[model samples]
Target: MSVLPLVFTSGWASGINAYAVVLLLGVFGATGLADEVPESLQRTDVLVVAGLLFLCEAVADKIPYVDSAWDTVHTVVRPVAGAVVAALLAGTSGSLPELAAGAVGGSTALMSHLVKAGTRMAVNTSPEPFSNVGVSVAEDLGVAGVITLAVFHPVAAAVVAGSLLLLGMVILVFLASRIRRFLRRRAQRREERSLAGAGRHRPHG
Candidate 1:
């Protein structure tokens, strides 16, 4: 009973088939799909691949400057995945439900991306490479754990994951704004100091 809803919800939210196709594309690139798997086993493959991809992404996202680059790449990929998931899930239901699923999946993906990106930016500001790597690895593990659980128990996982993604976005936005303001202030102070130093150095003419 539980497994059916979980599968249905995940499928509806992201179009498990579509997600599988995209995941294969990501792993093998464009050429890999030339030799197709039989239709029957494709869904199972996709679920496995999607779980792995999400785990990989979560880990890659913690890699300091590398993570920033990863996020930039995913800016395109994440939304597409979300759309696919939604479409897949929607196929099980009616039109209205399909649209709703797409919206939820896309929004959740976007929120997750933004929060992860912001955290990477903050990590970049830190000087300790070891600390950054450690944090990144931990984050990847946490994401993988949750996603694995979601795969096994999607309904509860979906609600909890979606809520966390939303909360993360809010926090990231607030922190990013503060970081920007601090940088701006620091720049202004440095400029003022430089100007004052120049004045002192000028001859009394």
Candidate 2:
């Protein structure tokens, strides 16, 4: 079987949590669960770094507003990770061209990351923190489930990942206005706080 489907699935998962995808794939490779995974991914150093980053993301992703900041920081990192992983997978199998696989992986990651970021922005508009934690947990489980599935059943995993990507895009479209409003309100609050601080610091006549 070709590795392209697994690559695409990984790209989708990477967008949500690159570190989790890396850690899971490394474990799969090291344990001989999946031969399609690259040996480079199974390196001890790679596993260690991915594990640490995954733990960091797990905590940061559960906090309101903080997840959005983390997502912003990963905007470039996720897509790059996806592309590199895909390229390595393609290079291993020799079934597909590496450049094409890289493009597919990178583009998919970017789109998925946008959906995640936009959704988080909309979620942050809410007052409670529980929803953020809930969403983060869901994403983590979803990434683990999909990545594991991709190893055993690549085609099925790709179908599931594609469906999720489509659903997220639809949700983003629905929440676009809400996300924009949330950003505007957040900026307004920051400006108000800044002005208040300035007033307090000003000299009295």
Best-performing candidate as measured by lDDT = 2
Give the winner by TM-score: 2
Write candidate 1's Cα lDDT for 24-101 as tens digits: 323332234322212322455665776577667556655656666776777767666665555554454343465665
Model 2 per-residue lDDT tens digits across residues 1-205: 6888988998999899999998999999999998888899999999999999999999999998889889989999999999998999899899989999999888899989999999999999989999999999999999999999999999999999999999999999999998998899879989999999999999999
Model 2's lDDT to the true fold? 0.93
TM-score per prediction, in order, is: 0.57, 0.94
- Native-to-model Cα distance after best TM-score fit, residue 78 in candidate 2, in Å: 0.7
Candidate lDDT values, in order:
0.53, 0.93
What TM-score quantifies how close candidate 1 is to the native fold? 0.57
Task: Give each model's clash number.
Answer: 10, 0
* Runs in model 1 lying further than 4 Å from the true structure: 1-62, 92-96, 177-205
